[model samples]
Target: MNALSQTHSQGVVMTQAYLEIRDLVKSYDGKQQAVRGISLDIRKGEFVSFLGPSGSGKTTTLMMVAGFEMPTSGSILLGGREIAPVPAHKRNIGMVFQNYALFPHMTALENVGFPLRMRKTPAAEIARRAAEALDMVGLAAFGGRHPREMSGGQQQRVALARALVFGPDVLLLDEPLGALDKNLREQMQVEIKRIHRELGITTIYVTHDQSEAMTMSDRIAVFSQGVVEQFAPPLDIYQRPTTRFVGSFIGDSNFLDVTRQNDGLVAQGIGALNIAAPSQAGKFHGLVRPEAIGLWTGGDEQGHCVLSFLIEGLVHYGDSVLLIGSAAGLNLRARLPSVQASHLHEGDTIRIAWRENDMHLIPVQ
Candidate 1:
């Protein structure tokens, strides 16, 4: 296991971890490492998402856990026992991929029952369980339909039923819903989250889509370069990211360079901030999420973290309006509710403010 995974006092072992990934490392060309020394413990019944950009090693990490990719160093524990050298079939982990990978010749019923049949399950039992799984995915009526006969979303659901019928220890998803349209993708996200909540299956999901990760994962392992930058709950990762990359990757944020001072640090163009966070001399980044800063239609800049900036633009985000403002040589992003946004417009003098603790410090390297 990686140092991070071993540091946990209690490794989650549900009905046997469904799956455990420890200190995984993978290199494609021998010199360039794809997956750095990464480690994560997926609890039996927990939904964890590996969210990162392409080539950031999220897929490789999942592959190593599933025995499709071998790690140069470290061990993967499934059911409390090590499985580094075990074959894929022996691992008994269910996997769902972006490509449905269903057989063109077989109907949905046959595809869903293939895994069970491979294990030589009784014909009667296989048919019964397959129907049940198909029903769970809302495809009971389309059992005889082939892959070509089903919609992208329906086909993906058949793939899900295929993975689930066997009741494997862990469910691994690698961009399983990427093929669907946006609306269908969103619907699938909710459907998957609902299924996970109901079944409490230990799941390891890999995706470069941040919104998907944030919406579905119980916790997220934010990967960059080749190593895991930070592993934290979604809210914590978004609100209080430990690294500059995490701040930039997880959500929408406005960053400004600052110089540390004894009492309060001086921001680039917004003047001094009265935040009480730790300060260093050289270079630091002040991160403020759009929601953390609100557009001020009329408020005096008496408190800390408040500034006067010209409203540059506004983008409506359904529930809230994103105000693009500028002040102190910095571009400000403030999110206000629709009601507040109605009162403000582009090119107006807009005031911006945040709480002392709403601002955080990340020493720039």
Candidate 2:
């Protein structure tokens, strides 16, 4: 028996952690680390996403949790017991990859039943359970179709079914929707979120796409340079990012370098601004979300930071319009509803204002 199975056998009452990762570090050649001392505690049914750019250690951390990569130092506790020493097969963790990894010759039913069959399940039980799994993924009618006979989206559903067929303790997905087109990718994102809600299984999804992570995950761990820069709910990560990298990564933001003045904070071109945040006297970055900026329609500008925007370009996104402009030596992007932007055009100088609190601060490093 593995450590987890042995822990269950010992009848010791363990903590309520469905999954726990503590101080995980992965180093190659003992010089540089891929995952540097990251820790997270996941509840029994929490849906968490590891979001970051390529080679930012999100995938490396997921691999460590799935037992595909060994951590140099740390503990992965599943069901309140350490599973780092357990073999991949013994860990009871299911994984779905980007390529789908289905057998070309085997039908969807056979593919979904492969895991149960490997565990020496009865033929009758495998057939029944496989059908149920396919039904769960809305693919009951496509069970007899082989991988070559199915579309990319259908094949991905089959892969998801196969992963969930055995009712594993945890599910790990590594960029599973990357192969589909934009429309299909969006459709799959909804499907995955629905399945996650229904199953309520502890899941860790790895993706470089911020939209995908924000749409599906209950909470996101933003990875950068082998560290988790911020881990919070999607809206929290989006609205109040703690770092400059996170602010730039998650959404369209204008970061203005501000200097602390005797009265308050000031930017080079925008003059005196209302800064309610307290910080040391030094340089800091003010994060201005694009949506927070709107056209200044002859208001008093009291309690708000108003600036003159020299419009450079415009992008129409059907429902919204993106205004790319410059203000006070800072290039800014502002998103306005199409209705509001209809009267505006390129090269028009307009006043733009954002709330004082909307400007979040990240100290310059």
Best candidate according to lDDT: 2
What stretches of model 1 exceed 4 Å from their correct place? 1-14, 279-283, 297-302
lDDT of 1 by residue, 65-183 (tens): 88898888888998789988988878777899999899999999999999989999999989988888888788989999999999999999999888878767778999998888999
Candidate 1 lDDT for residue 73 = 87
Cα lDDT, model 2, residue 319:
98
Quote each prediction's TM-score.
0.90, 0.93
In the order shown, what is each candidate's alpha-carbon RMSD? 5.6, 4.4
Residue 340 accuracy (lDDT) in model 2: 95
Clashes of each: 5, 1
